[model samples]
Target: MMKARIHQRPKSSMQSGKAKVGQWLLDYEPAEAKRLDPLTGWAGSGDTSAQVRLAFDDLDSAVAYATAKGIDYDVVRLGANPLKLQAYADNFK
Candidate 1:
């Protein structure tokens, strides 16, 4: 059976924008074995599903996609981080 992961995108610590925080991402777990090419000594897989990343505006939509595709998924929920409201003058202090 194919497994997928559903999780809300975490806010970037480097910036204070909410561009991708509200989005949920669905990622497929790799179910295929990676084989090394003897000529190049490189590992790769032919499974294209592992490379797919589906983004949804809501968690329900992401879950629905996995259910419709019959993929077993594990939802990872994260609690909201507490924010310390600071002003520009606070930086000087």
Candidate 2:
């Protein structure tokens, strides 16, 4: 069975306007083992699911997609949105 995670995107550390903060993301955990390349010694997995990231406007849509695909997912809820408004001019103060 494939394991997935559903969560909201974390706020940017830059304290910019919350333009894309409301989006939710669905990510899959890798079910494959990483193999080291003998030539370059680079480690990587062949699992394409690990590379897929589906974004949704709402939490329900993210969960619904996971259910339709038979994927077992864990929803991680983020803390309340940050309310500390900042301004570029404040940096100079």
Candidate 3:
């Protein structure tokens, strides 16, 4: 059976803006461990499904799609969203 993971897009560590933070993502799990090519010395795998990523607007849709396709998936839910309000002047204090 195909295995997949469904989770929300994480907040960017480089920027503060929360744009597209909640978008759900479906990613296939790697079926086999990557092996190093003896000739080129490059790490690669034959499982191309691991490269596919499907975006969903919400968790429900992502779950539905996985169920319809008979894919075994695990949903990773994030903790409660916490917004900390602060002022620029507070940075100096």
Candidates, ranked, lDDT: 3, 1, 2
Candidate 1, residues 1-93, lDDT tens digits: the string is 899999998989899788889899999999899999999999998998899899999999998889998999999999866877789999999
Tens-digit lDDT track of model 3 for 8-29: 9999989989998879999999
Model 3: lDDT of residue 28: 98
TM-score per model over all chains: 0.75, 0.79, 0.85
lDDT (tens digit, per residue) of candidate 2 on 23-91: 999999999999999999999988999999999999999999999999999999977656876898999
Q: State the C-alpha lDDT per candidate.
A: 0.92, 0.91, 0.95
Candidate 1 — worst ten consecutive residues by lDDT sum?
77-86
Residue-level error in angstroms, candidate 1, position 55: 0.8
Cα error, candidate 2, residue 10 (Å): 1.1
Model 1 residue 89 CA deviation in Å:
5.7
Worst 10 residues of 2 by lDDT: 77-86
- Per-residue lDDT of 63 in model 1: 89
Q: Model 2's lDDT to the true fold?
A: 0.91
